[model samples]
Target: MAQGVFAITEQRDGELRKVSFEAVSEGRRVADGLGADLTAVVLGSGIEGLAEELKKYGPDKILVADDAALADYTTDAYTNVLAELIQSSDPAVIITGASAQGKDLSGRLAARLDAGLAMDCVEIKLDNGNLTYTRPMFGGKIVAKVEIEGSPQIVAIRPNVMDIVENSKEPAIEKPAVQVGDLKTKIIEMKMETGDKPELTEADIIVSGGRGTGGDYAAVEELANELGAAVGASRSAVDEGWRPHSDQVGQTGKTVSPNLYVACGISGAIQHLAGMSTSKYIVAINKDEEAPIFSKADFGIAGDLFEVLPAIIAEVKKLK
Candidate 1:
């Protein structure tokens, strides 16, 4: 009988991503509910060390694919090997974080295996033998619950959406030598942003600026540093060349589901809301009280961000 719940780990430069643990934690819940074994799969050359770390979160098995070609993630190579693993193991569920890499791999796997798919799931619940996913829809205006039919249901959960739990279970190790050959799409070069602050999507706290900053990120970046929060930008800020496209938080940019999201001088367009409306706590600082941001904020400050940011940063530094 099919009895596996697989969590596909995401790694960059041979290190496991935070969302991989969250997937394992969620997988543990589903495994317990369905009485199936939980397995963690990590793919990269010399990534056995990363796979070994999965034991803390309680998986029944740890499968590591160590190959030099797997060092950098390429769509065709990942899709090919992972598809082969699923076909041979015949898992009941496959969970991956809906990251840049995850979105690509999960969809390809679903198509390759003829499995059902759910994307950007905020919550995963097992009810009446069905796995249901809750996600935002229609530009964050609607909450949608979805379920997939058939075996090997593929779920791509949003980053930071699920919490990881420690169970101290040591999962058995397996090093599968899946034949990974030359691929059509190869990673020639990769440029990644590096900093002490957490990544925008993975951060628990975020401070975002908009057109109101007048292309000055000094105050905004200072506030973010004080709070140890990631920095984000509205589309206007990116368009004005104040922030890079990577920092943009909206429909045209990256989606973030942080614990605390601070919007400064942002008018909160629907496109912007689509990316960050699901944040656990929202604080909006804008001079315009009638700005759309106020409607979604848990706390609203009807004042200039220039004046407000320094005050908040000082208080946060004191508190920290």
Candidate 2:
């Protein structure tokens, strides 16, 4: 039988990612709602310091699995370790970030544990100790609230939807002895993609361009750089080769819940809104006043993006 909720925290480059904190925060809220203990699992190479960092988030327990082979992200290694932990701990709920790495790990963990998984959930709530999850369905046109029917419910949350709150409790650390096994796959080479701004998934502010820019992304890029925002693209722009697929922000692309989302030259499509509509603030710059994006935008600018973007960039630079 399961006892409590556990949040599996993800880390990279020897530090914890923001999504890890978001998972922890979500776990804390769910656990409190159910009157259950909230625990966190930190797995990485040379990560003895992570326990103290996660303790500030009010986790009752911090389970640490540190090993050299676990330094870099490997699907096989992580899946094996997490599956073993879940089998032993028997947590009622397992929450992870719906990030690139998290998505992969959650699905594998679900298969290993034979548990039902709710992916890319925007909200999670516990009703009478039952886990209810809200996830997008049918290309994000509709949202479905589902209840997991088994022990150790698995959930992957979209980044930034949940706020990471700091609690003044010191979490006790427990070092778990993991059995190292032969790997079926080995990570031979690794490449790091460098960008001046933060990743779209993790950025606080995002400025995105679409097909309306007529394949000229200079204005959009300049404005994003001026505002210290990450550059994002609608699926149309990405498919048209105006931007890389990695920069695409839409239901079929990356789902971003940034603090501020600025859409330029992009007509608001339902799929695009599905990814970014949850942002705290949304600003749309387009020539068409009747654009559907303006309906969901907090602020609207009816003008050519080429003209509006430069002015906004100049003003932002002056303010800075």
Worst 10 residues of 1 by lDDT: 186-195
lDDT tens string, model 1, 1-320?
56689999999887789999999999998888888899989999988888668999899999998888788888888888898888889999999999989998898889988988998899988887678889877756688998888888999989898999987687789999877766787556777666677988999999999988988889899998988899999999999999988899988788888999999999999999988988999999999989999999999999999899999889988986
Q: Candidate 1, 260: how far from true, in Å?
A: 0.7
Per-residue alpha-carbon lDDT of model 2 for 56-105, expressed as tens digits? 88899999989887887788888888788888888999999999899998
For candidate 2, the lDDT comes to 0.88
For candidate 1, the lDDT comes to 0.89
The whole-model lDDT of each prediction reads 0.89, 0.88
| Residue-level lDDT for 99 in candidate 2 | 90
Candidate 1, residue 244: lDDT:
85
